[model samples]
Target: MSVISDVSIPPARTAAVSRRFYITAWRWHFYAGLYVAPFMLMLAVTGLIMLWTATISGRDGEKIYSVAPQASLAPVSAQAEAAFGEVAGQIVQYIAPRTAEQASLFRVNQGDASYMVAVDPYTAKALGHWDRRNGLYDLADSIHGTLLIGDVGDRLIEIAAGFGIVLVITGLYLWWPRDNSGFSSVLVPQLSAKGRQLWKSLHLSIGFYVSLILVVFLLSGLTWAGVWGEKFTQAWSTFPAEKWDNVPLSDLTHASLNYNGVKEVPWALEQTQMPASGSQAGISGTPEGQPVTLDAIITLARALGFDQRFQLGFPASETGVWSISRDTMSNDSANPLHDRIVHIDQYTGRILADVGFADYGLAGKAMAAGIAFHEGDMGLWNLVLVTAFCLAIIFLSVSGFVMWFKRRPRGATRLVAPTVSEPGPLWKTGAIVMLGVSLLFPLSGAVLVAVLLLDLLVIRHIAPLKKTLS
Candidate 1:
């Protein structure tokens, strides 16, 4: 929607105010774009690679096999044994195929490294194996998440995303069609226009189209950020351990279920405490004669309607329960509403806790659905839509750079940012709003404060710096 429109105002009274507001927004937009453009391009490129690779070759090389489905498939126990035998590591997790044509995947840990063993369900033979976190898709994911610089990169990206919101806001303010510009300027790019005008038109039109999607992506990605995500949003939105009735809690939380730098726990349960297995505190899901084995657990899972690409995480400690989960995060189900997690006692094979989407709180539910939509895990259309949005982001970022280059005088070393005039009441109000945003996102707020200090103390004070920036 347009942020500004033509209105009847006496030029003598409102022209200066409108001009000042527009200039302020344009200045913020320009500076934010200068900082955020690179990260936006990186995220879009890496995100596209991740999406296609995840859909085609599959993460952890799970799609490398092409075995014909047999009339009868090997038992789950035999498949697990075959995978374990091939990898020569402790079996930590089992991923059942979503369909008969797909291969069974097993997560094996040998000492420090973790590997995924893909097995043909028909023959119970290990098809191939690869490093779970080093595969092509996982590599893209690592870069997407942390830029390969770990926590430092994470904070930088988080700050970029926060500023990205500012960029969108200020961008909308600058883009809002006024006077007789009409739908042509808002909906379609004027390819007939040349140089900066054409670039500006394309950028504005494309940016407007993808603005909502970008915001969604930014918010969803923020939920995984270290400080704001882990400490603030996810901390409060997490599922409560009190839902487990009288069961004793383990020292470990559901975050422990995420393996090899991959998040596997349902978004809602990541911060919830894991229930211990020793107590006879749960209903028996296993049959009377059956012992608590991988096969028995499979049977129990199947009985509970986990027939698709559900995952099973073996207990890592003495008190840990076997985790059976099916969620959109793992691409197990397209419908986030069907997300489920069940913890079973490894000793007694009793179902300790069963959580479904319905059990989630309001925030948990929104995050669950938002994450699924963010990852394009909901359906084929979702993937296509997200891909188009990524392309739009890349185009907008590039066009912005092109427009800046064209606007700058030849051989100029200056940043050529918009000139800032003395602050008016409206400008002060806008600054206060930005400060409020900074308070909401601490990292971005800190960066904003630093930029303000630099601008006021250094850029505005020094003649050369002032000439360069203004």
Candidate 2:
């Protein structure tokens, strides 16, 4: 018992208010899980498939990326020429080998689809070629990013991820051991518990351990979302165009390089203005009057500290400048701090501007490191850790649905909110938190508005809905 207004407040009343708060949190968690569980499950499955595909095979197939080690290596130009002989199209990008045992990659544009031609670095042999859009990596990645339905799917996923974040927040609050329970009660699943309690214990312990990694996954994944990431976050964190002193800017951003729903460019630099070519204001690069070739650019890239693993992007148009980068998002290096992107004048081959990881804004810097961790691009240990975390997410999603199915009343399986009969508003305690989450993710905010309207306009008037929720 406690004093509220100089009068004694009954313990039962206090407990009722507390229980309502618990119900409120639980109800929100239930709804969020209902919506997000499917997306989370899909994302986890696709992500796991991608990780395994990348680990065991090349982007195309088993032999494309692998090559025999050789003491001698062919010229970079020769590798491109060899790949060009096979694809016989404009080479838009060049991917350097990550190891001596790996083949160099070239992107050849043929009509609407882009072809990936893997060439041997030593013998300049075109080992194999395949349409990148039809490849396994892009197939899994597009679904992971956009569900393969383009912008609409992207928005849906963004909403789910945003709401998923809220789910995590409310879940953490609900899972906090506020009772007279010890650490082991929450940290370890109770083996003695049976039925729903057993599943719940397992869910709570899994959620507790995997929460941080889940949040990372959500945030990093959102970095590619159409609205939340592109419109809002990118606006604030994009590298300033003014950095390219006195250089003419192109209408396109580095995002133009992203192909077939796969992000080949670094997240931090995606929205940065791409500089135009035909400029004299640049550092000494290709010698004057010397025709810039793939060989020259490759040598220059090596001299500039970009070793084996880097990308060379050809200009899309006549005025477009060449882009050379080695970013962790593209699996160039394990260390995010080593990320770098340099633009060069196509005609002059002059170094127009160079941006590194340190040059990104605070948000950009966080995303730079975050994307690496999210993609398991760091190393072998990182790959294993992320794989385990993704597996945990799959289990969490399945177990959540199991718990719901067990407790749902007959004929009310669409979505059932936990019963709360507190006298006042259930939203009172969590309004600010909900508002904050909505503001942080605008797509989620829009969906929240729709859901609120549904609750007020439809659910309140419907007998089954009102009965199930209230």
Candidate 3:
């Protein structure tokens, strides 16, 4: 497993083309790896931490709310009353208890501060309170998603993810078994090999196995990214506005309800208009004479088969609706096919809309399943698989850095990056790929162009890079 060696090319006319593409692949693989390695390492480490914490303490502060099961539990309103008393504020949302031994959660807003108030369902006593999203897992998640710096972090991560995809493509090409190399070299690390061979063997074998799964993980994770996911894909894949049956829509969308970077609603409904409460046309929701209180909404939610764990969001404004929903992102449901959100008019207490897995567009539906798989929320099996993949990513990141360190031109302090051996038709094809990546991920594409321009404008004229691409 030597670098820049394609002894696999036999007596064939396209050997030149094949050889040129191989070097092209190697060059870009090297380039993408340099930029993507650190980001990938951070993603894997934080992802594993989040997973471990989720497994041990629970994703939604369940440890703070764990309670002893009782013969009879308190009413939902009593729990809300207790939570309000503890927080001394309005209960903006409620997450129902998943099981008998778990207490319910209420999001209370007291002035400018918000808190997650945990109440024991059996006795309707305030169990505890924590500032919303102030836990260790939440901090790790914030970094994992946006690096805790908002939209700029989001764009940086999106570009990293895009380059991550490029890494997979080019690495696979570089790892494609040459005629001289056996499948053993691709599948297994050779222990008998020493020094650079050992590192090369490990890096190649691990990169080959992890590349496919890594791409799936990256694409699924990118759905939450601001640029590629939201600006482009989500806009086209969202729930159809026409499905609302001419109901007067509110000025705000479901995205308005997602606070503190938490997705309280489904991905498909994020941009779709929230139905206004003033609309009179809707299916039966709350009882006709029942005053629409938090208790009434909870009662309606339970009756509508929203028992166990589900988020019930209070109306945000006069025209807003009481929202009840379960989605994988919220860690409420394991199965995306079972994901759904229902809106009830605040004034009329009628069902304004109910969007489920079936309502999602094709891409939306793919994202639904992909998101569940991405977060390892589907089940224990998925959790194990995602954890294993995270570990593999960490290994790849380390092995890649080791290989680069060992293989860099000896005695050279500056970069000695590999380049294609000769200028040929492959450059034209690569231009097409760069075009595709730029279009698919506009932000990352801009980065690719900038790097290319840097090479043309600066690197070539500089003292270091004129050594000619091998």
Candidate 4:
């Protein structure tokens, strides 16, 4: 027998090991894409619809138009009154217009329902009113978040997002150019190629281009999921309400500030407890003998340099404070660094707690900035970039499905997944890395374990299933 080198494996063994690793990765990638592609397509389409609707027409017809910017504008109180007159409800929130020519939005509560009323600032005329949560934009957002099935859908989407990460990894591995293949093979699609080659080129190139953005979108969107997001990441990353000096705490959280069940509160503060309004626990900003009206709070907000677009959340109860917030979450300002939330006593109009972006923890600050970018709120460029990213996602999903269908045996009823081989040392290393990832994302981890069990106990044992899958 030929003497084997003590320091190195035989070339044949090395090639076999590499091939096994590739097959294993491809198998996992195929399964993940089989389930995740549809959801990814849904999210991308809905996200695109929401982005355009929010950017161009505004949510729920909140956008108002005027003939031109007037030299003088009506008082916010008059605008609030105009909105209430149109909606017939207790005014709960006021949104200042970003520009004089734009319309102001007032949120009104009528019985159990909440409505958004648009009033032209220049004319103080009620432009329109609609149910805040029942609008087209909100519908699209709900679909994106929960697939219109609530918590179950949220969990499913979270699993899909987790698999999405796996899909990207495996895709990158398969797309890795070898030998003399260079930038053109990796970056450019071979449109001139026929059949499977054409599909593979388009799928790989587009998937590679959008991989980073897909990760960002999935991570940010995961921040809102019921499990990994709400119970794990958000629970720890939330702004600490205890940072308030000697302030009376409320039983409720900053989640209470979410008007009409919409996520209006900043991401970092959403779970933080709200400071109560009693005990004279704040600095006085109330004018002498002047009630804290919408006008007064608007004036105070302006005085504090919340000049452009800012939101005022009316006191929820007798002890609740009027919440004045100016943050990138609401697209109030372009800079996340300037995010601020001020609570004025409903009874005393005193500034209770003033939390700024600088006060947030490292994670909190990152989330605040991440949310702004995720929403495409930075500028037109941001919108265009996200739009392209969304389109790429849809194209990738569709291309993946097309490639799968074309590769399957004609008229086959079973799923034609890649064949799996026994794990080599390299395969085991990949498994270890995935285990770490699963630990970080609990829901994802659970699903991964389930898949492993199914493969070992069910898929591998059943004759038809094994034949179909492999």
Number of clashes in every candidate structure? 0, 0, 0, 0
Best by lDDT: 1
Tens-digit lDDT track of model 1 for 1-470 = 76887687767557678777888888888888999999999999998998899899765566777678888878889999999889998899998887777899999998989998999999999888888778677877888889898999999999999999999888887888875678767789898998799888889998888888888889888888998899888888889999788988998888888875577677779899999999889887787566799888988898999986889999998998899998988878889999999999888888899999999988788878988998889899999998999899999889889999999889988988777575555677678769877988899999999988998888878998787776
lDDT of candidate 2 over 341-390, digit per residue (tens): 88898888899999998898998889889988887888899999989998
The digit string of per-residue lDDT tens for model 3 on 105-160 reads 99999787889988998899998998887788989989998888999988888999
lDDT of 1: 0.86
Worst 10 residues of 1 by lDDT: 420-429
Scored by CA lDDT, what does every candidate get?
0.86, 0.85, 0.83, 0.83
Off by over 4 Å in 4: 1-7, 421-426
Which predicted model would earn the best TM-score?
1
User: What TM-score against the true fold does each predicted structure earn?
Assistant: 0.95, 0.94, 0.92, 0.94
Task: Provide the lowest-lDDT 10-residue window in model 4.
Answer: 59-68
Clashing pairs in 2: none
**Model 4 agreement with the true structure over 52-103: per-residue lDDT tens digits:** 8888776535464543578887898899889989999788888888776678
